[model samples]
Target: MTATVQPTLDGTTPPAPVDYETWLAAVWPHFIAAAASGRTFTCYSIADTNQLPDPPNPRAHWGRLMHQLRDDGYTRPAGWTCSDRPTTRHSGVRTWKGTAAAQREAAA
Candidate 1:
């Protein structure tokens, strides 16, 4: 039987909780993996990355993951300048690219 769709008291369904372990898993969707790989060669604007790599990824919800990856040395900024585009957390977003370490990680 199909489940009936129901709206919540707030007229919206609550967001599903993130499975942190799964989100952190090495094996991700091809798009996410590809984006990570692409970063090694080119920079991507975070604002434009809202629907990146095609197919979709959890990054749309957990944008901070990109910053985490950068902090971990998996990615780096294209430059010191903030993007002209706006974001939820910041007035302007930044561009990022994969680092050599990320390339090696992707290769593995």
Candidate 2:
């Protein structure tokens, strides 16, 4: 039997309990494995992250990731900016391509 769709009066469900930064890091390997299996996922950005429980401030992980990117010479210098480019088809129809062939396909 189909379950009844009981609409909430206040229109809210319980918040997800995942610790956002830890959740992000823990799932990183899954995202990477998906790539090896010919799928991928979009990434989170510092600006778009949600607030988290206090102490150790949850955004620290993202901060470290950016620092590593900078240290690995993958970022710009002198007050530049970047994007959270989606690298997966599963993220729905949103953006165009990033690289050469992907751009061609998105255009075509």
Quantify all predictions' global Cα lDDT against the true fold: 0.51, 0.38
Per-residue lDDT of 12-108 in model 2, one digit per residue for the tens?
6644456655665654443233223322222343222433222234446545544443354333122322345354334432111123333343345
Q: Candidate 1: list runs displaced more than 4 Å.
A: 1-35, 40-63, 80-92
Question: Against the hidden true structure, what lDDT does model 1 obtain?
Answer: 0.51
Clashes of each: 1, 0
Assess candidate 2 and give its TM-score to the true structure.
0.26
- Give the alpha carbon lDDT tens digit for every residue of 31-105 in model 1: 245445654322234324534332125546345566666677766766444444344343454556777776787
Per-candidate TM-scores read 0.43, 0.26
Error of 1 at 5 (Å): 11
Instruction: Rate residue 20 of model 2 by lDDT.
Output: 51
The C-alpha RMSD in Å for every predicted model, in order, reads 7.0, 13.2
Candidate 1 residue 92 C-alpha distance from true site, Å: 4.1
| Residue 95's lDDT in candidate 2 | 16
